[model samples]
Structure formats: structure tokens, C-alpha cells
Target chain A: MPDSEGHPDFDELELGAVLTALADPIRRQVVAVLAGEPDGTERPCSSFGLPLTKSTLTYHFRLLRESGLVRQVNRGNSRMAQLRRADLEARFPGLLALVVAETQQAGKGAPSVAGNTARAPH
Target chain B: MPDSEGHPDFDELELGAVLTALADPIRRQVVAVLAGEPDGTERPCSSFGLPLTKSTLTYHFRLLRESGLVRQVNRGNSRMAQLRRADLEARFPGLLALVVAETQQAGKGAPSVAGNTARAPH
Candidate 1:
């Protein structure tokens, strides 16, 4: 993806940076929205419905793409994001599962998890 | 555990911060050590033998404890850290599992964080 400053942004981030970028709920929502999205396809920056402003949204997307979590290609005047599922999962196996599960659990379910305790590996 | 400055450091960290703190391999290793570790117990910061300086080691432990990934208690002059497994598991279910899986993948296996290609979720 072509970074606005005429440089490559998505290739520069390390695994930790990408994971850190994805840790936020807002960012996770962006990733979930992206992962469920198609490859070589792009989603508009504004279509995701974030709580922050456009600039902040830009920052988040930039971070994601930078960390190799998402790849952004310029579409006309807007930026479209596609998640690096294969790239990241290869780099960190079961990571995508972890992200998807956590994001889904955090968003779709709200059961206080009061009774869910560790069952020790048998 | 009590925060060195009076406040509870572990309690103050949010879910994202906790995840962020654990994103690093060193931190994750620490968590693995603490998790496989028993509760109501503590491990000295030096026992793990991180490559960073003592101050940096202190900093990482502080960050881990602050993030609720680990709990620290003053054990003489050395602080013993424990993973708040139950508390964290309650706060974010399946999270400890995710951490364990990722850390193990990153450490025990030195397979380059390479791409395994995506298998469409059919």
C-alpha cells in the first residue's frame, strides 16, 4: 500500500508494534471489521464508525497498517484497509484466532465471566 | 499488591495496556513463568534473567504487574511477582489461554514468524 507521504508504511512495523496497535478495542473493532473483509479489497476509513475524529481514525489505521495487521491501498482520495491475515498468522500462529475470539467475546458477549475459571491442563 | 507509590499498580492498567505489556516476548515469557507459577507466590525479577539492564528489568516487571498480567508483592528488598490468573481470566476470558499459546509459539518454537497462508473459514 502507498503511504500518503510517498513511503511504504505497512512494511515497517514489527510484531510487537502490530500487536500493540491491535490491543485497543477500537483498533480490534477495526481489525475484526477488516478480517471479516476480503483480501485485495479496501474499506473506507469512515465506514467503520469509530468514536474518534477523522485524524485519530487516520492514526489508528496508520498504526494497524504499519504493524502489518492491515494493508491499506489508496482508493481515489480515500484509504482502504485489508488485514494481513496470512502474514500475521504465519508470524504468530493461533494469533488470529486469539484476536478474533477476544474481539468477538469482548463485543458480542457480555456475560460477566464470573464462573469461567481455569480448568488446569489435564 | 501495593503499588510502590501508594496506589495499586496492577489494578490501574486497562485491558489494552495489559495486552500491550504482554506483546513483547520477554514480557510474555515472564507471564508464562508466572502463570505456570502458583498463586499467593512471587518470583524475583532477576530469576527470569532478561537481557535488559536491571533498571529495565525492574521497569518490565513493573509494567507487567501494573497491567494485571502479574501481581507483585514486596518480598524483602526483592519484589516477587505472581500472575493474577483468576482475576485476569475473569476480566478477559480465554485471554490467559491466548497469552500462553502465543508465548509458547514464540518461544519453544523458533520457527520464524512466517506466513502459513490463510485457509478460508468455510
Candidate 2:
């Protein structure tokens, strides 16, 4: 079981960190998927279907987790991921919604997120 | 007069770019300052008073400008900067407002944005 203690609390989340985590186009896609999931449904990490190595996906997930945007936990042998929507909304209202909307827009062949990187901000 | 062609147009702005530009604490502080200024008020870049070198400040301003969050133009030899609030708001509604609000919450002695660099996300 992944410890909930590892996650930053709502009040503990920094706006910069949260923004940085969502800065990547791939991470924004992850958030869009999780945000649309039913409440309390923790989807397995592999379910995101991003075209990246497991290691890269893990790194992105860790960024989201540390930034308090998402929570991951062990469910039997699988690690599940879910958005901390309620907590994030409480802390910074409408932030996630805008990102999700943007992600959807990007998917629909809108302007690309050029010059953005998937790597953590150094 | 800085050429408007140098800046990305509304349709050209990317969500990831904007988020990445706001990812840095110093840049967010810069945005907070510009967001509060009156309509059409172009503040000189040096007037921001950030404890950073001129090169570093120029880099931050470049990131904000390229990300379409700000516009800088030459005003009688002094480079003036202003938030691209109207453009950003049209692209991503409520995004700037939330960032400004979160910045205010930060000002109230909230949790600090540690680990976020003043440098660009490389």
C-alpha cells in the first residue's frame, strides 16, 4: 500500500509546483483522463496508454503526486492513479478544469503546445 | 516599437507554454504584479524590483513573452512589459485569475514554493 503520508496536503501544495507539474503536455493529458474518471475509481497507472516508457510515465506520475495534483496507491499488485480533484479544487478552484479543457482542445487538433517539455522544470 | 509579429497570436498560444511560463515563482510574482496594473498600463521591466540579475530578469521576461503571458515593447528606450491578460483570458478563461488569487494566498504567509527555480524549465 502506498502511504498517503507521502502526498502533500492541500494547504501544503505550492502554486508553482502545481503549475510546473501541469506544464507538460503529456502530464496535462494524464490529468484530463483522471479528472474525467468517476469518483473513487483508481485506474491502474498503465491505463493512461501514453506512448512512453514505464520509467518516463513513472517520473511524470511522481511529479503529479509530489505537486498534490494526483494520488497513486497500490491496489493488490497494480499501482492505481487518480486525480485529487476535490482537494485541488478546494485549494485552487477551476485550475484543473481549465487544464482539462485545454487538453481536450489540443486533442481536437487545436494549436500545439510547442516549446513545452515533459521533463521536470530544472 | 517592438513588432507584434514577434509575439504569438491568440490561436497560436499553447496551454503548456502558459503553464510552464507560470511555473517559476519569480515569474508568477511578475504576473501577479502585472495583473494588478490598470488597463493599458505598460510598466518598465526594471520597475519589477525582483532580486535578480539583469540577465536573469531578461530571461524570465523572455519566457513570459514567448509563452504569450506578457508583451514587451520599447517605450522611448525603456522596455515596457504588461500582462497579456485579455489574450490569455480568451484562450483559457479563469486561468490568470486563479493564478493571481493563488499568488495572493501565497502572499498571506501560505506555504512557500520551494524547489521551484527562478530559471526557465529546461
Candidate 3:
């Protein structure tokens, strides 16, 4: 597993890449979950319970990390992911909030691919 | 050129599609330019001066219009485009502002494909 060293520096975060990484419904749901967590809290990738294969989840996490939206670190045997909230807020103010808001709205209104129902216990 | 009838309504604007449309640097540049204009101001598609073929520019504008980010209307032989500021603000507050701010920052910094230099007089 690659380490946080691969994460883009705050100054290196590009708006286009970040937005592109976040354009997916699943990715936005993952981001919304991380955004809802208490500050500094890190959760393992499995904790998301997204309706995706393990490899697909891994791909999503890698995209998130490379886009500077999330930071991933090896936690024992699990890979823990944390939103780079402060960095994102500083780099693209109000962007994260909108993601969270939109995700929540989607979760409430429709049965989207990334909606809460999609995360039902397996 | 299709009329605004093909445009997505405010309620039909999906976050994923909107973000996907905005993910491109060229599209972001167009949004930034429209955002900077006075409220209700509309500009013809050719006015953007983007470095792209006519067909490619049409594709970008279509994506923008279909995503509900920009509204386009047939003005004689030319199509005029305007940012759907009010609808976007009502649907995803702060998102457009972030787009504008990031584009401005990119414009001032390194020369990017969507930077101000790319819009230099042809």
C-alpha cells in the first residue's frame, strides 16, 4: 500500500482534478461520510460500506487521495481514510460544504447509487 | 442550434452531472467568464475566445447547458450563453463562487490550459 507521501501537497491541488475526482456519485458519498465524521477522525475504507467491489473502493480512495481531497494512511492491516477538510476549505472554500449538502439532499430524496440505502448492512 | 427547451430544469439538475460539467478547465473558464458578468448579462458563444475548434466549443457549451450550469438562448444566428446564477445559488449555494475564485486563482498563477493566457486574442 502506498503511503501519504503520494498525496499532493496543498499548493499542488488543482481545481479541475479535484472536481473531476468528486464528480462521481460514489466518490461524493464517501466524501460526505468523511465530512460528517468528527474533525480528525479517520475511518477504515471498509467502514464506508459502499455498494462497490473492494478493488473499486480502492480505486476511489486512490483518486480521492491523489486529488488532495482525502488522505489515506495504513492503519495496521487496514487503510484508514480521512478528509483533508482544512486543506480543502482553504484551497476551495465552500466546495466541501456543497458536496456534503448535495449528498445529503440526494440521500433524502432518491434511491441514488450513493444514497444511504445503498450502504445497507451486508 | 437547439433552443433552451433541452436545458435541464432546476429540480432536474443532478450534482454529479453539474460537477462533471464543471470538472473541465475549459468549461470552468466559460463559467468564470459568465460569473464575472453583471447579473442578466449574456454573451455570444464566440465571445469567449477559447482555443478550440467550433465543434469542440459547441460540445463544451452543450455540456454546460445540459448540466444546468449555463443557459443558452438562440439570438438570431448566434447563441447567447449566461450562467444560471440564481438557479445554481438556490440549488447549490457557494458552489459557483468557489468555481469563480478557483478560476481567478488559476488565472493569476501558472499558465494553465484554462488560464487567462489561453483566452488571449486570437
Best by DockQ: 2
Model 3, B1-122: lDDT tens digits are 44766699989988889999988888988898899889888998888877688999999998999999999988888889988999999988888888888767766765456432235454
TM-score of each model's chain B:
0.72, 0.84, 0.86
Model 2 lDDT per residue over B73-108, tens place: 887787888888889888788787877786676567
- Model 3 local distance difference test score: 0.82
Rank candidates, DockQ, best first. Answer: 2, 3, 1
What is the per-residue lDDT of model 1 for residues B2-120, given as tens digits with 9 covering 90 to 100? Answer: 34542244345455666677777788777765665456456677777566899999888777766667766665666666677777766656656655655565566552332222222
Worst 10 residues of 1 chain B by lDDT: B113-122
- Model 2: how far residue A80 lies from native, Å: 0.9
TM-score of each model, paired residue for residue: 0.59, 0.85, 0.86
The CA lDDT at B23 in model 3 is 84
- Tens-place lDDT per residue, model 2, A1-122, is 43684699777987878888898888888888777666655766667667789999888988989989888876566677778989988878888888778667656773333222222212
Q: TM-score, B chain, candidate 2? A: 0.84
Candidate scoring better on TM-score of 2 and 3: 3
- Using TM-score as the measure, the top candidate is 3
CA-lDDT, candidates in order: 0.64, 0.78, 0.82
